[model samples]
Target: MTTRAWVLHPDIQTNRDRKDPQPALEEAMALAHALPGLEVVGGEVVRLPKAHPGQLFGSGKLEELRQRLTDQEIGLVLIDGPVSPVQQRNLEKAWKTKLLDRTGLILEIFSDRARTREGVLQVEMAALSYQRTRLVRAWTHLERQRGGLGFVGGPGETQIEADRRAIDEQLTRLRRQLAKVVKTRELHRAARAKVPFPIIALVGYTNAGKSTLFNRLTGADVMAKDMLFATLDPTMRAVDLPSGRRVILSDTVGFISSLPTQLVAAFRATLEEVLAADLILHVRDISHDETEAQDADVRRILSDLGVDENTRVIEVWNKVDLLAEEEQLALIRQAERREDVVVVSALTGLGVEALLAEAEHTLDEVRMRKELILSFSSGKQRAWLYDQGVVEAEQQTDDGFVVTVNWTQGQARQFHEL
Candidate 1:
């Protein structure tokens, strides 16, 4: 059954926000839509000077909105901000509807979208942590009298405490399981290290055309959708660059503004791919009104993940096809002025070659040219160099073959280790 949902973005006047309220409301509605079986009947920005402790809205305003929700038959109300457990319970009781906050809604979407075992476990842990704080709301039945022997003076093992304990136990178990999964991932990363291919990770705001760009670059049909968080599990594919260098391209979960803290902690293992990336492509929907704010959000998340200061990041202004021709020309001109920015339409393959060239050039800028001498007896090393496609030129000398190669520090280290 499709549950009717009403989205409300509380515009806290005292709080300073870089984004406009209307866009925030729209994003909340889109998040509500991302979950299946939820039909958003109405959405609006609710102005508030301050939040009420018991209920988020003022008494009269709450009653007014409650009547409107009843009239509209909204079964669910999604608040696009934090709601204390007490406030949530009070609001739900007063409004006669289920209530979900921004964190809860995002967690629901993640629970529905997580495909991998690691992703599932992470979501489960995050949800449990969130649920743990809401045990007060879950103990509504505790108010009812319980028939029991009067052995203990006080109520024995309150429902809320029991529920919290259960959730804690489950969280512990999930952590153990997550540790195993993370260990396996570490092993996989170690194996990939032997291949010596630079990993390029794509990161940006949700629905920023990262998967589309991934598909365009690697010819991999990852799910590309207009909806937020269309991609959750980290996907990797080897892509041959314009320079004939093979690099691993990783498409990771899209970031969002005000991302749930639980999610950041839970998905740390998944985001380690970004930390290990040789280059990060911060994709942006150039046509979106909140693109600048979204860019800040992505950077904040990256910084939280402890991304290296020296890591190379290229700003990919994507979705240029949606822009006007004049706007597109202006953006292209702007990108031409900066070496780190590339404007491309991933859907139409427009300027994608340039993106690839830029990626290659950025990776190549760190390369160190070295002269290596290989005797005839060292045929294996020579074959390895040729296979790597790093051998720029080779000349046979009386003693051996002098090979000039251009390779990254990592590749050079790998060769010496071999």
Candidate 2:
């Protein structure tokens, strides 16, 4: 049976930097809908002057919400912000329903969506870390005595302590396995690095239509849906631009505001493609009211992930099909006035050709000019440079030849290897 769930966004008035509560509540509802086997019956933004340390909600508010949840037969309550273990326990007991805070709910979604071996292991490790913190005394089972070997905790050890130890052990094992998986990924990256194609990464807020754009650009059938976090694993495909330039396009997991710290840390490897990208396309749901806020969140995450300040980025205003004709024209006009923005609608393939042409132009703009001297015996190297169409001018010299070439950083590196 599907679990009937209710969502709540605590709009704490004391937090001056809080996002607009209504949009935040709407996002929470979307997140609730993303998870399977859960029917979101209702959601609302609950106003509060401050949080109650033990229960999150005030007594009167808690009683009112409890009655409403009970009447609707809500079996799960999703709180749209951090909830301490004590607060979660107290709220669950008061409301007589299971509870999940933002971190827990996101973890659940990742656990369900993770498909690759590495992704599954990463989720398990993060979930264990989260579960470790929740091993409080409130759980009756944790109070039971555990018989332990003297090598570990002594006899009469509490089950909570034993459980924590077990989680630690599992974490250690997962770390070892993850190390192996990451090594394989690194090897794959090294191989790609030698392919002489610039990498272009697509990054954006969840459900911002990145996968749709990725499919449009590469003609690869990746899962593209209107649901939050529809794509979890990073996928890449080599695409040929109209200028005959081949580039690797990577579509990665989407970013969100107030993402769990555990997930951010754990998914760093998954997002390594973004770090290695020669150019980044920051896709945006231009029709959404909170698009600007979502853009800020994605940029903040890229910064937090140590993306270089000098890396080139282009803003892709996507989902223009969702807007009115006048709105789309206005966005197109605004984009035309900017050098680093492209207005597009991935769903209807609008402005995609222009996007590709712009990308080609941007890459061409980053090419560097270099001079190289080759000996008479380096005929193969000279031929390779000519084949790459990077040789601008060549002069025969006493040594052999002095060649001036215009190429990208990747091409320069490949020339050196040759």
**Best candidate, TM-score-wise?**
2
| Candidate 1: tens digits of C-alpha lDDT, residues 147-204 | 4466866555566676778899999999999999999998898678767699899999
How does residue 292 of candidate 1 score in lDDT? 93
Give lDDT tens digits, candidate 2, residues 15-120: 8778799999999999999999999999999999999998988999999999999999999999999999999888988988999999999999999999999999
All candidates' lDDT scores?
A: 0.91, 0.90
Off by over 4 Å in 1: 137-156, 368-418
Per-prediction CA RMSD (Å): 5.7, 4.2
Residue pairs whose backbone atoms clash in candidate 1: none
Question: Which lDDT value does model 1 have at 257?
Answer: 92
Q: What's the lDDT of the predicted structure labeled candidate 1? A: 0.91
Model 1, residue 255: distance off in Å is 0.5
Model 1 residue 293 CA deviation (Å) reads: 0.6
TM-score (C-alpha) between model 2 and the true structure: 0.88
Q: Which candidate leads in lDDT?
A: 1
Which runs in model 2 stand beyond 4 Å of their true positions?
139-143, 147-156, 369-418
